[model samples]
Target: MVTIKDVAKVTGVSPSTVSRVIADNPRISPATKKKVREAMEHLGYHTNIHARNLVAKSTKAIGVIMPSSADKALQNPFFPEVLRGIGSVIHERQYSLTLSSGETEQEILAEVQRMVYGSYVDGVILLYSRVDDPVMSFLQERDFPFVMVGKPFEKLQEITHVDNDNFTAGKQITNYLIASGHEKIAFIGGSKDLFVTRDRESGYQSALTDAGLPNNDAYKIHTEFLKSGGREAVERLLSLPVRPTAIVVTDDLMSLGVLSTLEESGVQVPRDISLVSFNNAYLSEITRPALTTVDIHIHELGAQSARALIERTVDKTVPSRRIIVPYNIIYRNSVSEQ
Candidate 1:
């Protein structure tokens, strides 16, 4: 219950002087500032951020918006890696990170509305971008300062985003598998609605076409961003009479699931079917057969998103930015020549 007044009384300075010290006004004499700070420490004083926010019209905090249905995908290593990157910048700027996640679109959009109208955060960062997303529509409608972590399905010129060159990643990984002597390659990706999935799938197909490899419709599969999703897709694909000689999965976690299903079915990787995937996440190297994956620089994606949002918050007139982080393929023991 000790107030600024208590610090002012103890420090023998005016209440305004204590207030100026708390705000780091720089106008206060250094000697007086030191005494006021010491008195604040002795009084266990904390500045009222809420009151300051009212005056400054900013909370100095950023709200992160996860995918509408990220309950499962959020558990993946990608989110945490990106968060580390986002934290690196936001913390340096003395801003706090707040998260908004929900299992449904309505729930997620509602949280976003609360953040926007309630003045809870100075900016928002969306971790996923998809086609026809309501939350995105709302943000666009409000002209709120926000940044997306992936390509916007619409309003490309209006939305600022940071994304990986997933198409090139898909093509490079696919090309690598083909060069290693695998022809009958299958692709396992996430939901079709996701920009990431469609871009990667397009790249995979382009590589197949350029290499004169058969781009069989049956070889392409889409599933949830979950481990079981990989298991289920592989189970179905393995039952095909013309099984693929190799697989190009879109995510490392799903690749792990595919590896699990292969083990349980007595199908040896590389020896039976070479595998390549993306994300280069933590689990990729630890499996019995280390996976060859595309390193999409997940952390950079987050950092750039934070940097973009902070920039927009500072100067709303800044032109929208589209940052594409680079990717590279990491070869390991997962693939062998067919």
Candidate 2:
């Protein structure tokens, strides 16, 4: 095995310099670091990560905590896009990412405990935030370095997070429909346990209240974050004694489900009932009538979370912070005048 000492001897640099280069210590000048890396490559010297971690007391790896329903959650496609953004940053920083998730909250909690207690990761990136989440509580109690990808339900000052302004997003989309003469508009969202759902619901309600439009309980529905959930919501909405003129779905996958249900029922979208959704994901453009949805910059959400987590791992004293990515509504054929 070509050791660090051998590489240092070949490069005429000290062993300490070689170690610092491997650690990517910023104090080392760029040119010297390049030279050290080149010498290591020439000598076929590979640093044993385990041994280095043992000596440094750092794993050089991060844990990614997904939602409890991870298998179902990943079906939405937004998660993958967000991860691409995160991976772009961390991969170059010499940090590896490991994922932990489960079908239930307790299962997810168990996975997180193992990762945190086993010293398997230096930090964690949480993919979702929910009300009274045990995983969040556990990380907080342990003073672990972690970053959330969504707004927390509370604790405005302590947790570091990256998210879009969901409240304004919901209000803006609702106001758009109202401007288009959609008075009997409806809202469909994920479980109320999620802060994303709560924020968006508040925005929607605020928009309706400002416009003097009726915010009826009959028009608001909550269900799973899945296609079937969207379909069920549409069914319930259409069956109401007073049908809505338009609908605001919280997710693109749910919107896709809504479109499918409408097509099967011979209900022409935009013509029959204008529709809008969030997370302008891949399917938004290809739907029979491209969805006029909100693009919350999912990629930036991921990239920024990774950046924030990396910042946390480097300095514990850095005050916890918040990063809000921008959002926009893309006009497509799915939404039309009432």
Which candidate leads in TM-score?
Answer: 2
| Per-residue lDDT of 43 in model 1 | 64
lDDT of 1: 0.86
> Model 2, 47-148: lDDT tens per residue?
654554566578878888878566877888888888888888778787898877587899988988998999898889989989999999999999999999
Cα lDDT computed for each candidate against the true fold: 0.86, 0.87
Candidate 2 vs. true structure, TM-score: 0.85
Assess the local accuracy of residue 55 in candidate 1 as a C-alpha lDDT between 0 and 100.
Answer: 63
Clash count of each predicted structure: 0, 0
Quote the lDDT for 131 in model 2: 93
Error of 1 at 95 (Å): 0.9
TM-score of each: 0.83, 0.85
lDDT of 2: 0.87
- The deviation in Å at residue 34 for candidate 2 is 15
